[model samples]
Target: MSMSLSTLGALIDTDHMLRACCNNPKCRHYAKLDLEYLAVKLGRDHSSMRDDLVPKLKCSKCKSKNISLILSAKSTEGLGHT
Candidate 1:
């Protein structure tokens, strides 16, 4: 897939996806959402703005405000490519 014009970045257009993990080490609840999915969920054009998503994010396990962001190697299409 080709990259969108969105500020979320060109990585979103690729097969690989991004992961938002719980910042709290104890909290295991993490949200594995793609930039596209996140954009729709947050009613935005893209997930480039971290501030916009941080307030809305919460650890399902511990409900912590602290969160971490991770870029996954696996894309929506498949792995071992990106």
Candidate 2:
């Protein structure tokens, strides 16, 4: 059994899309806006862009899972650091 060229190409395209989605700055898991920028520059649809690079954090300011993004990180430093 052998896959067709289109199948192989589809697989590669899927992988690339997944990687692009993962690297998107709006992703809650990581911060990389360049991916989203590139996606927009390429004239990708906004709906697809939203699906691929939606902002994971409800609050970009704080980036807190429990609280709003407005939460501050001021006191989160290593107090015991020598």
Candidate 3:
């Protein structure tokens, strides 16, 4: 997939899917993030991946701010399942 015009350089240089995982030892919650939503919501502040996005994330289950990110190619349309 190609990068959407408004999404270029927002979260990443290319079109990709982002997944966030909780870093808490007892609560490892995982979730997929919508790049477009983040781009629109964050605007100019969404420049750097780790510097900007990481600080804004929290685990839905444990509400922990410690999170890790995973980047996957947008072209992998059916890879979410096992």
Candidate 4:
């Protein structure tokens, strides 16, 4: 009637997971980097020095139009890291 610790951990991780641009507080989106896409645009794999705008047009959690045209490495964490 009870799940194992590993199963519980997996469930917890899945439930708290957030997509790349979700910008939620209860996920690891803040710690991840979209390195592949960033590399293509920058023409290099070194993402640290690449200074180009990553265009994104999506809705925020508040259902507001969120348009971002800034560096990809910029902090998108609205509610801080999870």
| TM agreement with the true structure for every prediction | 0.56, 0.17, 0.70, 0.22
Per-residue lDDT, model 4, residue 29, is 27
- The order of the candidates by TM-score, greatest first, is 3, 1, 4, 2
**Each prediction's whole-model lDDT (CA):** 0.62, 0.33, 0.71, 0.32
Residue 63, candidate 3: how far off, in angstroms? 1.1
Ordered by lDDT, highest first, the candidates read 3, 1, 2, 4
What TM-score does structure 3 among the candidates reach? Answer: 0.70
Native-referenced Cα lDDT, model 4: 0.32
lDDT of 2 by residue, 1-82 (tens): 7632122233233333222123324543433233345444533333332433344323243453322111112244356788
Off by over 4 Å in 1: 1-12, 34-36, 75-82
Over 3-80, each residue of candidate 3 has an lDDT whose tens digit, in order, gives: 443332544556667888898999888998767677667764455465567887678899998999887777787776
Candidate 1 structure quality by residue, lDDT tens digits, 1-82: 6656334545455545656788777666777765676656755544454565668777777889787766554533454565
Q: Which candidate wins on lDDT?
A: 3
What is the lDDT for 51 in model 3? 53
Supply the global lDDT for candidate 2.
Answer: 0.33
Q: Summing lDDT over every window of 10 consecutive residues in candidate 1, give the lowest-scoring window.
A: 71-80
